[model samples]
Target: MSQPVMPAPIGKRGRAALGMDAQDLSTITERAGDGLRVLGLRFTNDRGCPAERFETLRARLGTSFEGIEIDSSPGNAAGIAPSAHAVLTVSLVDEPGHPTRVALDRVVAFLAEQLRH
Candidate 1:
């Protein structure tokens, strides 16, 4: 039986972002909720989290998972980390006829968006 390797604590920015949250990232999840779900994460190179590579995922979610609502916040903002992989925090709510699709359009489109001096 091969046990999966546990991930490291994270980089400097990851810790900083996780710390800003009072409850911390521990409160974040990725399971179906009572018509609602929230995902706030800082994607690190060490974690293999995707930033602008959710088109297929989004398309699948939109078509297969009907009535699923999603709200996303991805990037390094005030309380977020800088130069991290990608912060993909999303909230889903499946109410009545709302008419909406999951989108990851944020301040930074990709890691290259960050102007490194």
Candidate 2:
């Protein structure tokens, strides 16, 4: 069997834009609350994966997935790293709708599949 692929590390700027500090990103693999489902991913700069990829992913995921980028702070002394990190928020249409654990799983699976190629 193939070993599971680990996500790349995201930079400081990317983390802030996702409205997450390193701790939040570390403890929670995924979060479903409010009207949003948060999915996190780390990518190296060499991958050439730009912010547009998130939009494309959202489109491919269909209406169930909505991408949101929020401004956040560093939250700690950890300086920004050179790598890139991001959180993809998939908000459901209904009230109190958030991405369920299953949905988060699917998103991660989809992202893993995409990254393999």
Per model, state how many residue pairs clash.
Answer: 2, 5
Please write out the lDDT profile of model 2 over residues 48-86, one tens digit for every residue: 344544544354334434443322224312222233233
Winning model by lDDT: 2
* Model 1 per-residue lDDT tens digits across residues 24-44: 322332222222232223232
lDDT at residue 3 of model 2 (Cα atoms): 10
TM-score of 2: 0.24
- Candidate 2: which pairs clash? 10-84, 10-85, 11-83, 11-84, 11-85
Residue pairs that clash (backbone atoms under 3 angstroms), model 1: 39-89, 39-90
Model 2 Cα RMSD, Å? 15.6
